[model samples]
Target: MTRVLLLGGTTEAGRMARALADAGVDAVYSYAGRTEAPVAQPLPVRVGGFGGVAGLVAYLRAEGISHVIDATHPFAAQMSRNAVEGCAAAGVALIALEREPWQAGEGDRWTHVPDLAGAVAALGEAPRWVFLAIGRQNLSAFAGAPQHHYLLRLVDPPTDPLPLPRAEAVIARGPFDVAGDRALLKDHRIEVIVAKNAGGAGAEAKLVAARELGLPVVLIDRPLVPERRVARTLGEVMAWLDG
Candidate 1:
């Protein structure tokens, strides 16, 4: 009876799901329901939240989930924290599949900020063309600095009007290449980039594109999550499950 729950939303989570299926592990993939169309996975999938720590604990107990793997995006602090608390209460083992944060490289001009608000503050008073690589959820925070024009790349087109007055949307998905991102920056005439330090190969193209074009990026650091066991690769997560 090795039922497991995989808290998922990142590219890494997709890979982990496939591995779990191939291994014939009984697991459920859970999405936060932020995206309109999430990628198909091999395991049974559940969308939306589990209410909170109490709800998550109830689910784990009722489903007999023996283990939990938190393969969510680094910036998804709230869900990650809830998972930690829920698993502890349910007496289930939990491990996080987390990627390392990106670091500044040669030829890159980066201003590091602790969080989203700091990123907004870093974008000084002067008006400029900015590539807002952070997702659509936190776009309203930028309204305070309405002087600059923003280029937003989203997984789905906005159903309602965007929060920013000077913002335009480009509907697309990631696993994006550097050439395409470079062309996007050129075409949009982006002078700076505002992005979260969501570390992974799939979404690193924008940083690479910024480096090649000599653009300054205001990088926002990942939020702190409760301490939990972490695995950096698919092999490691599989090993943990086996153990």
Candidate 2:
């Protein structure tokens, strides 16, 4: 059996692992230990980072890894780059599974910003209410918008204390329900929402809710990735594997 390692954390990561398993490939799924009980996939799994590039290279060579599929989050720039370098060092096949980001449509009020700080800067002082869906890692930027109240939703409790005067945390995972989202928006009296373009159905209903409410959204663009062999879908990844 061919040995494949899947660097997983994204939703499609699980699917990609299953796809490889179905094709009779001996695949091992790896996660970055970021999530609290990430959804289980149908393969042997390893959690936590592989130290760095050197450690990953050692793992690749020692395990006789034939191929590597990077399915980490778009913001995981460091790991993605490490994979590219590590694969080269070990002479292993590498592919990136990246999905298209959600695009703004008619009735979608979007203000595209370069980063999280930029997203906060876009919110002017207006005694506003905002829904911060940017996850647990980077909520400190919102502290600058003290005039605004924020409704922060995260899977885990934030490690650092929030600087906002008025803020609430909702512990939940999604693909959220559009109706429930709409209610939360209405209940919080949110005028603006901040979200990252982490594509796919997981936590996507908030976008739908924002669209329905006609609420303005501050969308953070995805981080840039290094040049790599990319596949937009699982089928495409499977095809690459077959080839």
Measured by TM-score, the strongest candidate is 1
TM-score per prediction, in order, is: 0.99, 0.93
Q: Tens-digit lDDT track for model 1 on 99-174?
A: 9999888999999999889999999999999999999999999999999999999999999999999999999998
Stretches > 4 Å off in candidate 1: none
Encode model 2's per-residue lDDT on 71-139: one tens digit a residue. 988878899999999999899999999878899888999999999888988898787888988877777
Cα lDDT, all candidates: 0.94, 0.87
lDDT of 1 at 31: 96
User: How many times do residue backbones clash in model 2?
Assistant: 2
Query: Stretches of candidate 2 above 4 Å error?
Result: none
Give the Cα error of residue 205 in candidate 1, in Å: 0.8
